[model samples]
Target: MGIISEFKEFAVKGNVVDLAVGVIIGGAFGTIVKSLVSDIIMPPIGYLAGGIDFSDLFYDPTGGDYASLDAAREAGAPAIAYGLFINNLISFLIVAWAVFLLVKGMNSLTKKAESEAPADAPVEPPKEILLLEEIRDVLKAKA
Candidate 1:
């Protein structure tokens, strides 16, 4: 087959299509989680922590006084930005939790669906019963 046809076939395959869709959705999910952490969740946490900004939480190795992590970096100081790391860790936890709940719910639904579907196919009678019925039918036909 031509390369064009081969490429077309590969693109249209079910697994490839599913993977593309998953990547798109995952990117959107990541964006939503980022926003949820930065905009919604972090604000309250920061407020409760005495108005501490996570991105500003850094340690200057040279013990230089800077207004924020950005200021330290601007002044050419190698600061350990543990606060940003904390924010990212929180986001990762939230994402992992959300995925876990989603998978759990899907598994429950799948199990429920499987359980409700009965596999009780009709059983055939024994060969001896069939032979007896055939003989009875023949006797009746003769009568």
Candidate 2:
């Protein structure tokens, strides 16, 4: 087969289409999770943690004095942004948890579907058994 045909075959496969759709949905889900963490979840947590903005929590290794993270960056200070890492970590955990629950629900549904399906019909008796029964019936009738 030609290269173009081979490529077309691969691209048109059901699995490939499913994977592409999954990737698109996953990207959208990631954006939603990021927004949820940054906007809704972090605000309350930050408030409980003494009204601290975790995104601004950083350490300047050069010991430079700065009022904020943007100021530190503007001053060309080398800083470790641990707060951003924490936010990202929380987002990742939440996404992972959501995926886990989805998988659990899908698995339960699959199990239920399998259990509800009808079983295969039972096998009939062999031809030899039928023949023997017929012969026995004839001998009994003759007797």
Candidate 3:
């Protein structure tokens, strides 16, 4: 009823702990996805695009000649960083795809588990009636 008790109840709940774990794993997964995009995938694409560095892909709006995106940013110039955008778009797609596959696999697993359970298992009988019926049949046979 008190604030401390409510806080204790919330902290002890399994859902909150599971959520914390998920957040930690998601952060780690994000780092791996970022590395996979920037290190492995983008380099070859940049090479095909005439050795363009995706991070350095930008244009200065101030009409000043800047060597790279970093330089333009350092010079306080406004620029459209389309290359970084592309990289981020790809990362988003990859992460989405990964999550989709994970969810699909989990769904399939759950369905499999459900299907494997016995369909004929007792759903209703209270058990006392069955025992009483057996006792009645035994007494009738004795008579």
TM-score for each predicted model, relative to the true structure: 0.76, 0.81, 0.83
Off by over 4 Å in 2: 122-143
lDDT of 1 by residue, 14-126 (tens): 99999999899989999999888888888899999999888679999899999988889989999999988988899899989988999999999999999898769677999
lDDT of each: 0.92, 0.94, 0.90
lDDT of 2 by residue, 1-143 (tens): 69999999999999999999999999999999999999999989999999989888999999998888889999889978889999999999999999999999999999999988876867779999999999999999999
Q: What is the lDDT of residue 6 in candidate 3?
A: 95
Which is better, 1 or 3, measured by lDDT?
Answer: 1
TM-score for candidate 1, residues paired by index? 0.76
Best model per lDDT: 2
Worst 10 residues of 2 by lDDT: 115-124
Using TM-score, give the best candidate's number.
3
RMSD to native for every prediction? 6.1, 5.6, 4.2
Evaluated against the true structure, the overall lDDT of model 3 is 0.90
